[model samples]
Target: MTEQRQDPILIVGGGMAGALLALLLRHHGASAVTLVESHPLTLPDEPPLTPSFDARSTALSAGTLSVLDELGLAEAIREHAAAIDTVHVSRRSRLGITRLRASEEGVPALGAVVENRWLGFVLLRALYADAAIQVLAPERLSAIRRLADGYEATLESGRTLTTPLLIAADGAKSRTREWLGVSARDSDTGHDAMIANLSLASDHQGIAYERFLNDGPLALLPLPDRRFGLVWTGPRDQVDAWMEMESGALLKQLQQQCPAEAPRITGIGERQRYPLILTHACAQAVPFGVVVGNAAHTLHPVAGQGFNLTVRDLVQLACTVGGASAPGKLSLLQQYVQRREQDQALISQASRWVPEMFRVQQPLFAHSRQLGLVAMDILPGLRQGFARRAMGL
Candidate 1:
């Protein structure tokens, strides 16, 4: 593709990754960056009916936290984020427990949790205020054409735009990725993750718990305002049953599984469920563009590694393409893909294997799992390394 200095960079998704990518590009001195979103570009004074604008939370690691500076987001996320000082991992009905402490690693906190709506508010507010970034709302990509000099996209609203570089920042099911003819490797876990908010009877004390239960992995994250965020992964039938169960019954079940010292789960918030799948785009780049975020590699929410890894690559990509005369050149895009190999592969394997090993019913596997946790706790170096990686350091 030929270079055109005046042609703007088009990003196809206004979600966290897409919006943040636009900001990052701008940080790299890109003159014009455009973000196309499927939902209405405008957020009314009253809350809108968007899934992202909800009580559901996003876990932000110390590493992913750099997105604020990298993307030129001036607002502080601390007030909206609940600090995670420690993460206590365990196996239900087992005698294994390991604690990952931020203090032990010489970091102030391991990570932080912020509600999706709050994060969206901050990000969108910045996007709308920035004149360099153009946002097209209530529009979707209907068709794409690969040009000798670049690429062309026609939106559902009949709006046409062309640029030398087009990025697919759309979510897991990315239409842009499809248009680019990039194939993704997907694995269904045969489990569904049910998410909701939990009102705690006692303060969480800045601790998050990841428990391996018979059904699957259950994670309860500490939140601000004396609450907790639950990501309960289990078989479809069990998840469906839990979703229909009364709040009191659900509370009782959670209390039974929770740590003795943990505060009683008194109230439940809106419950939403989605199938768990691991997706990785076989090809991240081709002439004239590349795919990123969930579209490039949709990961299990095991350690909340999905967005952290994506953000890292976004930063690298901005640097790689920032001053290059031909940003859409194949060689430059290949370099970006090469730089991400190690982290992506390692995290993907961990997210897939951890659940399987813990979920096994065999006594041998169970004992081995317990031993692993014990080793992780006893070995200081191992523990520190894990803590650092988990915090996205």
Candidate 2:
């Protein structure tokens, strides 16, 4: 019988973040890395339908795309992604509109949007191709015992293994984080998001639209083949009602709410909805275990900052621990959390603030919000700063 060998690093979760972290670690020459996931890994011909990489789509910031380029996965992604040449922000029945353009920012493109399934497929292919990564799906980390050097983990199948480093990329309701005694603060945004693919009557021309309506913000992100990925947010009951509406009625409602500049909504695909909640872990690292991705922080989708921020965290963490002699050192993990504190705080605040700022129906606040959008348009420096942040620069 072949004996099970101890791995230097063990990552729990095989979603986008977890899988990408394994790839990044391998890219940085980290060997003997084992990834444990509860979900079954999909076949090469089938796109993964994991919770993180289901029918939903994601906007990849320029910074993230750059990281992918370094990892040599950008070309595969670019084939399916639609560039974001401009981001147009407007308020319903308001007098102000702001457009942040990639040309003005002196970049090729601000970002791009790709289906999460394809992204997952790319990562899975890379993981399987790398001999250094040991992917164990259809498996679960049942328990962990803290050791002086790291952790001793037991799997559901009664297999035992030890790793010097443990990472919790299991997502927002991370069992690994809980096992490590990390507490999370979850704030319900009082809103739910309905997402689906949209077919437009006209070309989107690579323009992403953010229209703030009375109920909630609606984002129509450009996608290939004259389609857009829709993130429509509102109260749970309202969204549920919309979910039940006939396609034609729903499209009509979207047309009424969307900005006139956006392409007409031609058709809608299967829709899914979930409550919007902002969650932040009280602490990011514990002794030898570290929390990453949605396990550490889950932000609102209003600004599309959630996954992008997670990618940044993964990159920094990989750079910090990859190829290190003591990969699971507590001090090193703490340092990784420290370096990410500012970025995490800022993006979380912004994600929360955007929706609240627009939710207020008061006259003075409305006027101020309108003026703010106008200012962002007229002031090059102001818009540039915002653009840079949004692009993850």
Candidate 3:
């Protein structure tokens, strides 16, 4: 029998964030990393509605691309990536249209969008190829017992692993964070997001759209092949009716909410429903456990900032853990919290308001914001700052 290890660093998820963390740690020369996930690890060429990876797409900020490049994982998935050269923002029934071009920002591109499944495949490939990492899936973290110097994790399959540190990358409803008794403040945005890969009549031309309606902001992000990844965030109760509507009728509703010149939704992939909620964990780390990714802070996809924020947390955590002799040390955890507190607070604040800035219902308030949008277009410095911040600067 193989010897049972007591000090391997155990990561408790195998999603993008978790897998990326293991790879980052290995790149930093940290070893003996083990990742456990409740979902299946093997993603078929046609992925299903799995927890880790599916057809849902994400817009990776330019800064995130740089991180992926630095970690040597970008090229592997470049073929599946589509650049965003322009962003067009407008409110329904308003003449004020704001455009931010990558050329104005002095960057190669604002960002890129990639299907989550492709990202999952790429991360999994890199993870499996690394000898220092052990990938475990179809297994779930059920319980944890924190020790003075380490912690022991019990899986649903009765397998046990003890490690000096534990990372909770287990999505929003993380059992690991609950095991550590971490409390969070979660605010439901009173909205539900209907996401799918949508084929449009007009090509995106590497352009993204943020069209503000009476209800909420609707983002049409560019995907390959004249398709756009749709994030139709609507009222919670009405989303079910919208999802069930015939394609033509639903496309009509979508077109009504977008600009008069917007593309028509021709076809769509499987629609996945997600309740938009913003979460902030009061405690990020304990003696031998730490939370990262959506588990640490789940944000609204208003600005598509959820993954970007999580990536930063993962990168910083990996670097901090790499330099520390003890990954579970309180000093290291405290430093991580202190370093991230400001950015977390700032981004959370900005995300909350950015969505509201587009609500065009009341005539007076709508006009005020329309004027604000016009100002954003006219002021180069202000627009550049907003663009830079949105690109995860």
Candidate 4:
């Protein structure tokens, strides 16, 4: 029998959450950590250019920015992110439009939109710069065993690592969760989101727009180079049809849908599609393992809060671990769970409920949503609260 050996905290999935958590842990003086990713760390040649933009982008809220700032990554992120000063929410059939301005909340910008790949690059840069954190790319976890003092993980390369804590940030389809016997409840909403980048004829002026149509929500987020990132959600069939349409035809349809901004639309970039699924793990932490990011809770991208929420998860987990004598000990892990459960539950419930409420065809619910937007516009406290929450403050 192979003898057990002590290993650093094991982080599965080298995506945003995993990378950020590793950085934060190192920043907080927790040096012994290892991050494993299935994909290679090196950027690909030609970088997969298409009309479809990155499959994911995140709006970094003020609180999240501060968290990154503390970790010394804000400057790096800002160098590549596009600042958004306002958000406009409207209905396609109605004239009702609600605008949220950063000035109203006393912030220089509402948030920043950044491509997922770029963010990954920045995180990898930071991790490499840190001596305490070791990242293993192109390696995947193949098995996990829980022991009295810690956990042991066997990677696909036939190597075994023993650590007291395991963090699962492998995203919605996390293999680590399954290996650990963690069950997740997932609901397929029968919707898919089509995302793309477009060169607009006019500048977005740092405004993010969300339009609710009879189908689903369509959002236009500002990006660099006079380009805008779009997330269009609708029924599976409709989304599939849109995906099948010729680039020119789809551009025309987009122009019609976004009349105020159509003139700015010019060339389309790589287009991608993702099926929407709402997934929540039964628990965030167990004896020696914990789930984070999409692995913990996956929500509709309509509100653009999915990644933001994941960042918050990392923040909370960091705090809990930092406060402990040994970062991954079982007692500390329990405290982590206790501290994060309420917030996670609240967000998950709200995400699930809000979409259903808006998806309803009932006139009363529509009126309520419209009214809620208006209320958010006029109520300073309410808007500030939301902004703060979104920022992960």
Candidate 5:
């Protein structure tokens, strides 16, 4: 096949991570970036008849907020997001709150809770608004080949293009990663997470709660209205039962499971379920490519850190490539991997271990878990340090 040369960086997957990275690169004066998305660009004409819901919602840490501010997407997000001023963490059977207060961290808000779709819309808006960026939606990648100086990709529509760099943000099942021969290990947690939207009787008051039950972690995140985003993890059979319940019954069950003094579930919205899986790529960077977002690491949604971690990957990559004359150079890619290797390892390890900490039936293990929470609460310096590290500050 004849080779078709291109002048811009090529990004596969127009999801949050890819769109954000494209915007960041454009902001840093990297022109001619092209994003290819398998999904169509137009928004669905009809909203959910019951309640609008997204499978995921991201908790933007303070440092993440700063990064978004630099990218000019912060204001757009703030305009649509719910500011979480407090995080209340506790055991399901216990009555005491373990962590609280955003003020203690010297930030106006601990984080912002925004629907995954809203974030995507904002990024798409920014991407389309930029004249230097080109987006191809409803397009699929068929194959990729490494060239002498760059890479060449073929679209399902029989179009071929070449660029210096190929970014794989397609997701955990990334085709680019597979084509490039990157290996990843997958772990099945034998659990599933059910996410939905519900309107509570009482206002959430911008509070985010993580209730650790014997089954798994249950999160209720405040949304724009009196509604809250719910992420509940448990055994597959149990989650299947919950998903099968009627709207009213499901709401009642949720209210009982959650510790907040919320009234009966007034309304229930769209509900969806996904199997929980933890996956980590053997390597995050290659000679002419790198994988970000779910493609790089897929974590349990218990901590709401999956997307946030992916965004952090983009931030680190941008910082590494900003000053380079050739961003796709082997030396630059190696440096990017070195700079982000530790942080990625730390997050992956911590995410894998934290859930295990709560699985212990022994008294000593339970006591240690409680003590760890207490330490995180009382030690302002430690909490602040964690917050900073998460934000990639």
Candidate 6:
């Protein structure tokens, strides 16, 4: 390979997806990578600590964990993580309930939960330690112009660099996607997700719960220290009211909402809310640039599938680009997107459809859902298939 083959593959937006992509590229034998983040990047001796009750978290599906393990990052992440051995899903005020156990699935755990800060810390630490990677933080993309063979990009600091490939992992509302003339189609789910960490009276026992109520889905993901990360989605007014309630009142309301099998909620922490929207980029690859992560698709959090899907996309992208003579070749990029179409489409559709399916108030829909849940629980093959999909396998 000539020096040109090692030319920096510029990546904009050094958040979780961008940072992870840089490392995955290197892991796939890409020699040079550049990561750009508008926010300052630093590696503190210790991961930033948040009050146990206040930190937000993400559940890493089993397949995602395997990818990280291949990158040699799982050990450090496991230190601050919580294992999810079982997932119990049910509908409130309904007779249907089902549990997916890692034991049945023959995996160590269905997934793991880690605070967002810690995950970022692990990714950034690895990126910073890699001599083959270049970090350009506290900087933003000013402009990008496409050339016949590559792209020339200017940073906010007025520095110019050229690369055959540019990646947009900026986020759901990615400006880079816009600069590349890619548009996103966003569908409002007519609900807001209120998130908080709950102090459980008893341990979570490695169980995560997804309970569908009259309003929306309530996801309780186990976190370390006997706390559960809560994502309660409902009407805006309801979420606002719950956000304003005193801790005791909020805990009582949560207790009422949760299943009888759920752990007791002793306290609730700082609350944050965001509207639920399903966003999909009209195109994932354009010329010298390709979109990934939230930039490519932002799914409903009902299934905790967004980041896990992004990880799979990044892994596929690394494999595709690593084997190409020209990383930004339009044909290669298109091939990558085409190969990922089925998985991405399935997961994205399921994420949007799950809440909508449960939201149907008709008696017929209700009975069908009950039958479906019951069938899934009683049938080993059906339950295993559902479990595998949820695990991002």
True-structure Cα RMSD, model 2: 2.3
Candidate 2 per-residue lDDT, tens place, 1-393, comes to: 995444669999999899999999878768778999888887699988888889888999999999999999999999999999999999999989999999999999999999999999999998898888888997988999988888999999999988888999999999999988899999997889999999998999999999998888999999999999999999999998999999999999899999888889989999999788878899988888899988889888986899899889999899988877778888988888899999999999989888889989999999999999999999999999999999999
Strongest candidate by TM-score: 2
What is candidate 3's lDDT per residue for 1-393, written digit by digit as tens?
Answer: 995444678898888789889988877657679999887787446442457587688999998988899988888767888999998998877778889999999999998999898888888877878887888877888778877788888888898988888988888888788888898778888889999788888777898898887777789999888899999888888889888988778877777777766677788777889998878787998887898888888877887888888788778888888646688887898888888888788888888887776664677987888887899999999899889988987
- In candidate 1, the residue pairs with backbone N, CA or C atoms under 3 Å apart (3 or more residues apart, or in different chains) clash, namely none
Cα RMSD of all models vs. native, in order, equals: 2.3, 2.3, 2.6, 3.6, 3.7, 2.3
Instruction: Please estimate how well model 2 matches the true structure, expressed as its whole-model Cα lDDT.
Output: 0.91
Q: Give the runs in model 2 whose Cα sits over 4 Å from its true position.
A: 1-6
- Runs in model 6 deviating more than 4 A are 1-5, 46-54
lDDT pick, better of 2 and 3? 2
lDDT (Cα, tens digit) per residue for candidate 1, span 276-384: 9878888999998899998998888887778788888888898888666778899999999999889888888898899888889999999999998899899989888
User: Candidate 4 — what's its lDDT?
Assistant: 0.78
Candidate 5 Cα outliers beyond 4 Å, as residue runs: 1-6, 43-55, 260-264, 390-392
lDDT score at residue 231, model 6, on the 0-100 scale: 96
User: Which run of 10 residues does model 6 get worst, by summed lDDT?
Assistant: 46-55
Flag clash pairs in model 5: none
Compared to the true structure, candidate 6 yields what TM-score?
0.96
RMSD of 5: 3.7
* TM-score of each predicted structure versus truth: 0.96, 0.97, 0.94, 0.92, 0.92, 0.96
Q: Which candidate is the best by lDDT?
A: 2
Query: For residue 292, what is the lDDT in candidate 1?
Result: 95
TM-score, model 5 to reference: 0.92
